[model samples]
Target: MGQKGKKIFGISWNVFVLGLVSFLNDMSSEMINPVIPKYLTDVLRTGELLGGTLMGAIESLSSLFKVAFGYISDRFRNRKVFIFAGYALSTFAKGALAFTRYWWDFLSLRVLDRVGKGIRTAPRDALIAESSEEGKTGKSFGFHRMMDTLGAVAGPLAGIGLLYLMRGIEIERAYRYLFLATTIPGLLSLFLILFLLKEGGQEVRKKISGVSALKSRNLRLFLLVIAVGALGRYSYAFTLWKAGELGYSLEGEMAFYALFNLMYALSAYPIGVYSDRVGKKRLITVGFLISALASLAFAYARGPGTLVLAFLLYGVSIAIEDTAPRAYMADLAKDFEKGTVIGAYHTVFGIFVFPASVIAGWLWQSYSLTYSFLYAAVMNLLAFVMMFWIRDKN
Candidate 1:
């Protein structure tokens, strides 16, 4: 039975608070994501030199940190401390971006922000899963993702507005103001998370064999396939880059990015709720199918108008993709091992993302956009086929 009036939208109060945290955090993040590549290229003078490769490298390193943070959180049986540190650290990263002068400066701030993300994500997800009522896991994760993407939508639109206001202003100057605006939301996120997040009764740490979390066959298969798929899904920095290559200005590209997030926000919860009713593995497979198709569309897009279609399809793929795989991984976890398993899954999956971006960048530089995206399409198709091996048992 539902919680009657005790809970909100079938999720616990902690879930709601965590979702609100993500909403504000993503608002701060998306404000900068759309403009990062452009800012590097035009303002920082690093575009032709280290653009995609460095973006990939920083993100990869951030993913690597998740392993350590996850292990520590499990070891201490404390999620709130790491989560508070993560949000606070990200808040610092956002404000620090106001003075970035070179590529390394940007890298340092971005990595710091991502470090916070890596630290908090696994433990936070474990908290949500553990707190959810039976049969509500998918919907809970979906609701959190919906709030997150809603912030993504708002952030980019806010950036677009700032871009217009700062038009005729120096590119770096405009971005500085954008950075300042994001800090407000960032600080709010930190404050809310600090006061609102709960650790509850801490569980005792269990001793498992070395890398014991990977002993489950279904979990192994799931992680491997997802990793393979992620190799094709390189830096989304390329998405904004492609839009600019097609002649859209920064504001225009941000608008499309907003559209992408809008579709994702609108669809994520519904898809998650549906996955709960149907099956997570089945919905995840369908996500792979949609992702393969969207990759192809991105490959062929020639104008902002075409990109509209691509982003919409990409949003559908993302909405379906976001909720299911992680929820399935959660389903496969032992009670005390959820954070570690989730971290391991993320570590393996993220290991390939750096190389994927490097390869995509090389193709974009040496080959063509079509080649770059088609490579991704093939990988997603492979992932789609691989999903069948997973049983999705709870």
Candidate 2:
């Protein structure tokens, strides 16, 4: 093992540093994430349909760039620079969101922020895969997800504290202060990526486009299954909105969102380790089933108790969905094509987020909130069926 291969508590040094980077970035991101929907509705006065459409469009549009950047990074054999640029761009966009008074400006800033995510995600995951010890890919991605979600857990709790501290301020100003403050952790994450993370010397393979990654039949099927799941996976903003619908105050809503992240943080690592032994496909299928169950819980939720169960189930489902799939993709890809394959996977999953969210919002605006969740449940059930058709052994 070279310098990058050295392990800290069984994780590669680069992987550990990247986890730290994500922890800080996610802390910044989640602080803003749980509040974005509320901010749009309460402050900017956007309707539910518009808010959800904007959120989905922000995610889907940026995600379209992943394959391009992933292929570029793979071609250049450089991950660090793309990773740094992406995070930096997002941090700037998020911080500037504090100043937006117009919905269009808000949408622009949000798209800029997600574009940063698109740029960084594939390269970052590929770096983690490259840094992992042999046969420990699942564990490596798991550790990264755990650290990332721990930051998510901390972010909302911090937001609750901040909101309390600013209880006397006007609500709009208070939200602005929160957005501005996210810059602190976002910048810290960039620091780690710039100074500590290292790119390894990867095998030289023949030049190929992102489409070349589609040669794997298993991967093609897996992408279809995940696309179905993505169609059902409404934005987390809906969860926060649910708390509002159930009559929770702002602090209560933040705490509720934190619980979801807490469950996600706690479950990711152990599940990752478990997948390493039992097989990622099995765990991933379970994740989709859990997501379906979570949707049903939300669809039928009558009060706080049902909401709690829904949040917990959704959290665990997301942990599995976010972690195991990447590791599974790593297992399938040639070493040289990790970024391209994972980027393609993310692209397929992300592209559907726009329509899913818009449809959910449309359901809420046109009929009822329960209908939106029911729609999600149906899509997840479809994905659950599709999962069994894959031929992968692990």
Q: Which stretches of candidate 1 lie over 4 Å from their true place?
A: 1-6, 201-213, 391-394
Candidate achieving the largest TM-score: 2
Model 2 lDDT per residue over 1-394, tens place: 5635588997889889999999999999988888888899999999999988988898787778887787788888888898999999999999999999989999999999999999999988888888876678899999999999999999998888898899999999999999999999999999898888877554424444444547878889999898899999898888888788889887888898899999999999998899999999999999989999999998888898999999999999999999999999888877768888889988998898789999999999998889989999999989888889998888
Task: Give candidate 2 misplaced runs (Cα > 4 Å).
Answer: 1-4, 204-213
lDDT of 1 by residue, 1-394 (tens): 2221246666787788889999998999899889988888888887532787887886776678776787788778878888889888887888789898988888899889888888888888877777676677888889999999999999998888878878999877888988878888988887887776667343324453354656878777888898988888767788778788898888888888899999999999998788888988899888988888888888999866678888898898988877877777777777677788778877886788888888888888887777878988999999999988887544
Error of 2 at 168 (Å): 0.9
| TM-scores for candidates 1 onward, in order | 0.94, 0.97
Clashing pairs in 2: none
